[model samples]
Target: MKKYNRIKLWEGLHSSYWFVPLLITGAAIALAFFMLTLDSTGKSGLMEKSGLKIYTGGADSALTLLSTIASSMITVAGTVFSVTLVALTLASQQFGPRVLRNFMQDIRFKFVLGTFIATFIYCLLVLRSVHTDAEQPFVPKISITVAILLAIASILVLIYFIHHASTSIHAWHIIREISDELESNIDYVFSENPGNSHPEHKRQLVEEITTGFEQQAYPILATGSGYIRAIDYDRLMNIAKSKDLLLHLKHRPGKFIVRGSKLVRVFPFERGNGKLTKEINYAFILGRERTAFQDVEFSIKQLVEIAIRAISPAVNDPFTAIRCIDQLSVALCHLTQREFPSPYWYDDNDQLRLIADQVTFAALVDDAFHQIRQYGRQEVAVTIRLLETIATIAEYTRNKNNYVALLRHANMIRRGSENLFEKLDREDVEAQYQVVLQRLAKI
Candidate 1:
C-alpha cells in the first residue's frame, strides 16, 4: 500500500467508527449482565412463595431468557475481539510512526474497556447463580456499593493495560523504523561522517581502516624553463579512443600528469580551442595533486552537524568540531586530481590536517561519552570508547604540531572517562600516542 493510505488505515482504526462500536458492544454486554441479574432474581423471587423451586424453563423466568440472549452476544463479542486483536498486532508491525501509533492506541484502549465489561459482566452472571445446598436458597444480598466498586477496579486495570501497551508499541515502532532507515543509508552515513555513532544507529563499520599509511612525494625543481606548446586534446582523444581507454577509465577534470603518462583515452568527438588549452601552472597543479586526499566533493556541513549532536549536553560546541573536520576536508579538497586513492597521498600539511581532523573527531566523541554516562548505556559507552581510543591513536600519529594542539583537549574530557574505559586495552591508544609524542620530541 501507499504510505498515505497506510496512514489512512491508521486513522480509520483509531477513528470513532471502530471505537464507538467497541464501546457500544461493551455497554451492551454489561447491560445484558445487569438485566440477567434482575431477571434471575426479580421474577424468580416474586414467583417464590415459601422456598426456592428449581426448574429449568419453569417459573416467571426472566433470568433464563436474558442469559440465553447474553450467551449469544458474549460469544459474538469474544470472536470479534480476538480477530481485531490479531489485525491490530499485524498492522502495528508493518507501518510507520503515525500509523502504528493510531493502531496501538485505539485497539488497546478499546480492548481494555471491552475486557473489563465482558469479564465483569461474566463475574456478575456467575455470582447470580450461587445457592446453598441443604438449608438456604439462592440468596444474593447484592450490595450495590460492592458491585459498583468491583466494576470500577476492573475498568481501571483495563485503562492501565491500554496505556502500557501503547507505550511499548510506540517504542517498538521507532526501533524498527530507525533500523530500516539505517540499513539503506548506513554506508554513505559512515563514509561521510566517521564520527557518527554506529551501533546505536543500528549499524557497524563494514571496512575498518586500521593502521593508515602516508605516501610522500617531493616537489620537482626547475630553473624557470621555457613553456611547451599546447597539446591538442582532439589528437589525444583520437589516440585514446583507438586504445578504448575512455570506456575503461573514469577521469577527473584536472590532472597533473608525467611526461611519459597518457593524458586521456576517449571515444572522440571534440571541438578545437576549448579542448586543448595549455595550463601555465601545470607544475603547481602537479605539486598540489601529489598531496591530495579527497576525490569526491560534497557538503561537510551535515557531518559538522552530527558532531554537534554527539556532544550536545556539555557544549553546543559545533565550531570546534566543524573547524577540525574542515581542516581535514581542506586537505581532501585539494585531491581533485585523479590518480591514487584517497588517504594515501598527502604532504606534511596533510598529515597535520589528518591529526587535527582526528582530534576534532575525538573531541566530539566527548559528547557521546558524556551521554554514555548521562544515559546509562555501559555497552554503548564501551563501543564508543573503543572507537575513541582507535581514533586517538590515529590522530596522535599524524604530526607534532597537530598532536600538541589536539591532545590538550584531553584535559577537557578527562573527568568522566577515568573509570569508564578502564577495562578496555589502552595499549593501542598509548602506543600510538607515544609514537606521536616521540615524533614530536624529535621536532
Candidate 2:
C-alpha cells in the first residue's frame, strides 16, 4: 500500500503544472535572501576591492533599476502565460485533449514559466530592500546585480520557449513524443515480472488454478468508481500468502470499475470478510482517468487518437496518420520479441497466490490499430501503411499467435478497403497485404 501511494504521489507530481514552478519560486526566494545577506555583510565591498565587477549604483539608482526590471518581468510573465495558453489551445484543437497532458508535464515549459515568474519576484524582493531615506542610505548592490543576471537569463529562456512552443505543436513532433512514451511504457510493462510462462505450460497452469473455483469463489466489490490506475501485485500476493487464500483479479489496469462491482474473486468464499475486503481494495488504486504508469494501452490509445484525428474527414492528413502507424509499428516490433508475463503468480513455496489478467501481444496490437482501422477505412494510403507496418512487425516474431494477430489485421485492412478504394488504390493496398502474407509465411 505504501508503494501504491508512492506511485500515486509521483504520478500526481509528474502531471502537475504548479509543483515544479513552486519549487523554483522557493529557490528564487532563497537566492534573494542569500544575496541580500552578502550585501549586508559587506561582501560586495570585499568583491569590489578584489577587482570583481558588481553593481555600483547608489540607493536611488538601485531602486529604479530593480523596479524597472520587476515591472518588465511581470509584463513578460503575463505574455508568457498567454503564449502558453495559445499553445495549449492550438494543441487541443489540432491534437486531442490527451496531448495537453504531455504539454503540461513538460519540464521545459515549467522551467520557462518558473524562470520568468521567479525573476519578477526576485526583483520585487530586491527592490524592497533598497532604501534612500536614511542618512546612511542602503542599497543591496549584490542582490540587484543578481537580479540583473536573472533578468538576462529570463530573456534567453523566453527566446527558447518561443522556439520550443512553436515546434512542439507540429504533428510529427507530437506523434514522435507519444511514440517514445509508448516504447518506454512497453518496456516497463513487460520487464518487471519475475518469470515468463512458456506457451506449452501457460494453458495447463491456468486450467489447474481456475478449475472448480468459480462456483465457490467470493467476489470482492469495489468501494469506489474510476479507472484502475494501478494495482500493487506485491501487496496482493502478500495478503493472499498470509491469509492462505487464492485470489483472482477480475480486472487489470486501464479497466474501469463502478462502486459495488466485483473487483476480485477469492476462493473459499467464507474467507472474504469485511477486514479482508478492505485489505484487498487497498491494493488497487482507482483514478478519475487512466494513466500510462502500468497501463501500456493508455499510451497506445494516445497514438491511435492522433491517427484517428489525422485521418478524419475534417483533417484528411494521411501523412500524419502514416507517421502514427510507423511509430506504432516500431513499438509493436519491439513487443513481438519480448516474452509476456504469466498471469499465474505463485509464492516461494510454489503455492498459487493470485491470478491476474495478462497483457498479450494480440491485445496490444488490437489496441494500437483497431480504432485507426475503423476510422481509416476509406483512406487507401492509411490502409496500405497499416498493412506495411504489420508486415514490418511480422519480421520480428516467429510466434504463431503474433503472426496470426498481424495477419488478421492485414486481412481486415484489405477487406475494409475493398469497397472504398478505386482501382489503383485497391491494387496498392492488396499488394501491401500480399507482402504481409508473404512476410509472415516466410517467418
Candidate 3:
C-alpha cells in the first residue's frame, strides 16, 4: 500500500468545492436531530413557556413549507453549479488552463455551494421531525425557523458568488492572484539568509556533497510515473541516521519521472531489509500534476502561462502581459533576497546523510523570463518589461553570479528583440536594454 502525506490529502480536498460543504451538511443534520428532540420534549421550561409563537401550523402546512424550501434550494444549487462551470470554462479559455486551478480553489465558490447544500439538508432533517399524530401533533418550531434563516443566508451567498465569479475572471485579477501566490510561496521556501546566494557558497556545498563520502550505492527505482510533488525530508534523514546509510535523491520536487526510473540512490549496497526500500519510496510523494505547496517553480510557471496567453496573437493584450512581468519582477526580487536550503542534509554528527538537488537563483531567473522572451519577443512593451524585470532583480541581489545570469538574460532579450522588432521598436527595446546594462555595470 502506498502511503500519502497529509498535505497531499488536504490539497486534494482544498482544490474541490464539495468536501467542506458535505462535512458541514452532515453536522447540520445531526444538530437538527438534537434540536428537534429538545422541541419535542415539552418538559423543558424554555420550550413550554417561550412567548415567541412556536409554529402553530398543522403537519401538512409544515410539510408543504419545508418541501418547497428544500426543492427551491436544490434547484438554486444546480443553477449555481452551472454558473460555476461556465465561469471555469470561460476562465480557462480566456486566461489559460493553468489558472483554472485557482478558480477551482476559490473559497467563495466552495462556500456558496456548501451553503445551499447545507440549507437543503437542514430543511429535510427538520421536516422529518414534524410528526402528524391525530391526537397530539409534534413540530420542531426552532429547527424550522433556523432552516428559514439558512435559506435567507443562502440567498446572500448566492449574490456574493455572482459578484465574485464575475470579478475573478478578469485578466488583472487573475494576474494579481498568481503573483501574490508566487510571492508567498517564495517566502515559505526561502529563508532570510539563504546560504547559497553566493557563488562560492553554492560551489562549496556542491563540492562537499560530491566528495564527502565514498560508498557503493544502489539505485531505488520509482514504482509509478508522475511529478515529484513533495519529499519527506525528516523521514529520509531518520532512515539514513538509523541505518547508517547515505541517500542521494536523483531529482527534486517538480521534476517528472517515469516508472522503473531511478528515484534515489542508496549507499552501502546492502540488501539486508526490504523496509529501507519501502521507507525510501514512501518519502517521495508523486502526483499526476505539480502543486504550489512545495514547488515554487510551479507557481512561477502559472504566472508565465498568463504572460504567454496575454502576448498570443489571438489575445494581443500586451498590457496584461506587462502586468504579469511586473509581478514576476516582485517575485524574483523576493527570491533573490532569501536563502535557498542546502542540497546536502547533515546528520547530528555533521555527516552528510542525504544529497538532494536544490533550486538555484540562476535557474529560477531563467524559468521566470526564458519562456516569456520566446513568446513575447515581438511585442515591444513585453520585451521592455522583461529587460526591466531582469534589471530590477539584479539590483536587489549581492551575488556576482546572479549579476552574470541577469546580464546573460538581458543580452538574450536584446538579441531576440533585434531579430523580431521593427527598427523603430528595436530602438525602444535597446534603450531599455541599456538601462539593464548600466545597472549590471554598477554591480
- Judged by lDDT relative to the true structure, which candidate is superior, 1 or 2? 2
What is the alpha-carbon lDDT for the whole of candidate 3? 0.81
For model 2 the local lDDT of residue 99 reads 94
Q: Residues 36-101, candidate 3: write the lDDT tens digits.
A: 877777533475486665565667888888999899999998998898899999899988787888
Ranking by lDDT: 2, 3, 1
Looking at candidate 1, the ten consecutive residues that score lowest on lDDT are: 350-359
Clashing pairs in 2: none
Candidate 2 residue-wise lDDT at 213: 85
lDDT of 1 by residue, 300-405 (tens): 2223333334345554443333332333333322221112222221122221111111213333334223333343222333323433443444333444433444
Instruction: Report RMSD for candidate 1.
Output: 22.0
lDDT of 2 by residue, 119-155 (tens): 9889888888888987778888789889989989998
| Residue pairs whose backbone atoms clash in candidate 1 | 240-265, 246-265, 311-367
| Candidate 2 residue spans exceeding 4 A from truth | 194-205
- TM-scores of all predicted structures: 0.22, 0.97, 0.90
* Number of the top lDDT candidate: 2
Ten residues in sequence with the least summed lDDT for candidate 3 = 191-200
- For all predictions, the C-alpha RMSD in Å is 22.0, 1.5, 3.2
Q: Looking at model 3, how many pairs of residues clash?
A: 1
Candidate 3 vs. true structure, TM-score: 0.90
